[model samples]
Target: MAERIQKELKEIEKNPPDFCSAGMVGGDIRRWQATIIGPPGTPFVGGIFKLSLTFPPKYPMKPPEVTFKTKIYHPNIDRNGNICFNILKDDWSPAYTISAVLVSLCSLLSSPNPEDPLEPQIAAVFLKNKVQYEEEARKWTAKFAMS
Candidate 1:
């Protein structure tokens, strides 16, 4: 796990996204602390959201668990941090790497998958009222991510 993360860290450092950054927590090889700048052209823009990534003892063979430690108002993420992204679930492939997962997560930050929602009310809000959806999302971002 250490070697894999060391390599990944180098890759991340070499070509990091402007909106995000991640590092192993407390110098532990298996746990990471990450921050995502909410995507542009979305209500979440300008917010800095936090998350934790925990790799399995046998990573690569199995997917790691990722959760948003900072509360966010998104249809695909539940209050309990259970992500409803397919790539993290059944759609995952052994060829996928941490960078791929982070890219997926960043994509999700702007374009949520309404078809596979974790918070039904939020999904409904997204479908029913775009203004309200953006407002609440911005509110959550300010409350949980900006500070």
Candidate 2:
């Protein structure tokens, strides 16, 4: 196991995030499974979202690949579970930790960023009809994420 990976695992174990829980997947420190609880007052409240993270050997130097395992109806996430968050992309820095990533994800759920969307259709709906978007997102959360 990589030293960085071990260190991250230890940190996560010591100080877990409030809205999420994450740990090694199948005993592989490089692979992680995360469950993020939806934030209150959002359309996603009461939903439990699952995610997968795969770290590169050069972790802490490079951002891990993160994907939503549970279905979500958000502008920043696509049907294929790909997330288009800036922190996971060009804005990433080694100073970020796994806990930081999870907290950021929780924030994203609480507030969707329609400006930079992975699913343009969803973004359009979110921008044009916020009520409709919230309705659909809430429905999807109840249908898919609740399980």
Candidate 3:
């Protein structure tokens, strides 16, 4: 398991995503810290969001537990940073790599899936009041993710 994780880490280090960067935390290959630059044209643009990925002992067969370490105002992400993405759940497959997951997270920032949101209230605002939602999202990005 460690060998597989190390291989993935090496691959990620060799060819990292333009919008996201990830590294193992300390000596633990199973734990990683990721930083994602918000996609351009999105409310989160200019913000740098942090995330934590915890790989289980049985990885590849199962998806890693991803959580936002930084505060973000998005319908698909709850206040606690729990993500509600299909790939992270039922659609997950062993073929998916860490780099792919990071890229997908950046894509999510650009196009949130309000229909399957983790935060219902945020999703409602996003659906009914897009302008307001953008405003709030931008504000939160500036406050919490711009460090």
Best lDDT goes to which candidate? 3
- Clashing residue pairs in candidate 1, if any? none
- Taking the tens digit of each residue's C-alpha lDDT, what string does model 1 give over 79-106? 9877999888888776887777887898
**Across residues 88-140, which tens digit of lDDT does each residue of candidate 2 receive?**
98999998988999999999988899999999999999999999999999999
Candidate 2, after superposition: displacement of residue 76 in Å?
A: 0.3
Off by over 4 Å in 1: none
Q: What is the C-alpha RMSD, rounded to one decimal, of candidate 2? A: 1.1
Q: What is the lDDT of residue 27 in candidate 3?
A: 82
How do these models rank on TM-score, best leading?
3, 2, 1
lDDT per residue for candidate 3 within 1-147, as digits (tens), equals: 788889989998999998889999998999999999988999999999999999998898999999999999999999999999999899999999999999999999989999998999999999999999999999999999997
Every candidate's lDDT: 0.86, 0.92, 0.94
lDDT of 3: 0.94
Model 1 vs truth, CA RMSD: 1.2
**The candidate that achieves the highest TM-score relative to the unseen native structure:** 3
Clashing pairs in 2: none
TM per model?
A: 0.94, 0.96, 0.98
